[model samples]
Target: MSDDLPLTAEDVAEIAAILEHSGFRELDLSTRRFRLRVAKGDGAQDGLTQEWQWAGASGEIAADVAGVQADPAAICSPLPGTFYRSPQPGAPPFVNAGDTVGEETVIGIIETMKLMNPVHAGRSGTIAEIFITDGTLVTKGQALVRLA
Candidate 1:
């Protein structure tokens, strides 16, 4: 199976139930041609539950504690496509290191199928780092910026 394979809500619910019963905070399943990882809880006071499912040929999954401050900054791809920072041929970037960003700020753009999608800062933070350079491909849930 591949990531392109269609999945249904029933599949998700069944997987969630399995995880809930097993007392495994995380679960990853993979076959010869497909793989996926599902995790529960965001480790915040509200404890938001988030699950990530990816299907592809040959994949791996591991379990980790939630809310562990592994990285202060996080980069997220607004959309799935190629990510570009520079405006045109040899233009300065919209943002650089040591820059502060508002919650509604436009950080970058992801080009998908000839359309430019604007990326924003999900939360207020500083541009601690840039993970990708100009004209780099990005996938969904892929980190793009790190917050301070």
Candidate 2:
């Protein structure tokens, strides 16, 4: 773990797991070769903690809702990560553009750092549009579904 050495995948995973197990919310480590950061959040599941924001080859790690407007009735990603429209592969999507959802309905899951973060519809409405494809990467505040 020297500043002059690049961290391997195992190294990063180990660090993240350790920090997560310790109930830490954030981690910042740097070396002459690379700089690494890990973020934690209390996900929508409530009480199930340890959601890390790590941007591997994606270049920039961001997890704040900002800078983008699709529709007044859009549901945005609460965090940055891979957006999965279904709970698992080859499964039906949680919702489609014309589907209706309730305030607490889960429209999708955002996968970050091996954690599945559920994205909910904050308001009850019919989805007017779907802005993202299944398994695509989504950024915080980037609208994924638009309400009618």
Candidate 3:
């Protein structure tokens, strides 16, 4: 996370590690601009077992579970921010439903404070659905697109 951001990637990792080592089933944290919830799962419910990993050099948090593959169809936000489907006002969106995209394709952009971060597809697929409207606020790990 940026120094200006409320939470850092290390903060999230520490929280997750604490939750995983404790008897508590879940943890929820909230701030003026961000919210995070982590819960233990029993092999049911989509996204219930998501684990956070710290990207040391980049200061980014990745959602993953050991030995478990992430759902390829859903493209989620890396952090809490205002999501923008188009590059700018009155511009065409980066991708649309039925559009084929590569793993590194830029599907949308998330604006946090004044920093604009590009959101990638992460896996190659055809866009199936868009879950958020342009310029809507999105939370970290919130699904923004579904692939076919």
Candidate 4:
């Protein structure tokens, strides 16, 4: 939650509205000031517990119209490393929300053992969300981005 893009209650509602038919099973976004988790109503069908956590808040949608919250494909880290969302500081991020990426698209970098390794999209789809910010410490298999 940057002051530049303040997350509001309306934004939460809007995100929930978007979740209704976004073809995504679940959507998770967290920032300094906002943490949101939206899941489909019948999430238990997948055998995943519908536990939720966000800034001391939790919820589940009971509406059948929005109960199909399935998880979108996530680009995860392969090794523990420093995650960089851009090639370098003062540079544009490799990808942003709504950006289309291919299986071979380089979305970011993971620096391990002082080596910067490029991270690929691993799948072809629009980048619906990004989880890690620039220069964060990411662990192996941590969800980095959500693809639709």
Candidate 5:
């Protein structure tokens, strides 16, 4: 129910039960820490197939249910935390869309457990997109920026 908390096994089961009663063939839910996919088996006779994946760990979507494209050149978060685009409030962001950056460029900062860790551009490239906004919670290995 909340973005900070991942769904438990029981929660998923309850959702599946609801889906079964509702006559929906499939359900895909993505939270900050996990992605849950449920689908009924073929022919509507077999039970549902449930798949759970850590959101940013494998960096793979079992099914592209949302139809969003993944950026191959994305700079991912090193750990789960709150992402900040600037050094401090009201400051200019480290990088913007179309900005050219080197491998060592400090693109942003991720605050985890009261520590601020700088997020770097792992490779040199022009900033193609900024996916996460300032001060948003991000999962480990979540795509923060895309390079062109």
Candidate 6:
């Protein structure tokens, strides 16, 4: 009998806690013009449920505008692994702020399960920023660079 009612804040909080402990990445809820989503891992999108009938096409347009795009400054990983910006321990990093990089330039290395995978620049541009630090874990599609 109670299943038809909307969820309370306490219920949502408990669900979030459970999702966090279970290693799930996301959860979503939607009703008419209202929608909610929670991401437990790295704050990336994990789930989505939409009530399309209430908002119509305008909501879809808004969602499309908010989507992320691939850019030249985007330094995608060569493989899934730990990312290191330097060539060796205690050495200066290969690139720094404002350094110009070509498409073939190696920006970092990704260590996957004992194998070293070299990461490269996808396009030529000035190094606007570095997103990850040395010895940090990285996943596929994670941004590692910003270009001018």
Clashes counted in candidate 2 amount to: 1
RMSD list, candidates in order: 9.5, 8.1, 11.5, 13.2, 13.1, 11.9
Model 2's alpha-carbon lDDT is 0.69
**What's the TM-score of every candidate structure?**
0.51, 0.63, 0.54, 0.52, 0.54, 0.52
Q: Write the per-residue lDDT of candidate 1 for residues 1-148, one digit (tens) a residue.
A: 5545655443544454345435678776665435556666655532223344344424344333222332446867644567788666587787787889888877888776566777888678789888988888765557887877
**Model 3 segments more than 4 A misplaced:** 1-72
Candidate 4 pairs with clashing backbones:
25-69, 25-70, 40-69, 41-67
Q: Please list the C-alpha lDDT of all candidates, in the order they appear.
A: 0.62, 0.69, 0.71, 0.68, 0.75, 0.62
- Candidate 2 lDDT by residue in tens digits, 36-134: 676555574221122223334445544232335556778887666789999999999999878889999999998767878888899999999898999
lDDT of 3 at 102: 96
lDDT of 6 by residue, 1-148 (tens): 2324465443444344344446566666666654556555443553222222233544531121112345655776544457899888999888887999998888888776565767878678899888889999765556888887
lDDT (Cα, tens digit) per residue for candidate 4, span 1-97: 4624565443444355445436887787666544556666674443122223334455543322222333558888755567899999999999999
What's the TM for model 2?
0.63
Higher-TM-score candidate of 2 and 6: 2
Worst 10 residues of 2 by lDDT: 45-54
Q: Which candidate leads in lDDT?
A: 5
Put the candidates in lDDT order, highest first.
5, 3, 2, 4, 1, 6
Q: What ranking of all candidate models by TM-score puts the best one first?
A: 2, 3, 5, 4, 6, 1
**Model 1 Cα displacement at 7 (Å)?**
19
Task: Supply candidate 5's per-residue lDDT for 57.
Answer: 79
lDDT by residue for model 5 over 32-109, one digit each (tens)? 787888986685344456788885676643321111234679998765567999999999999999999999999999
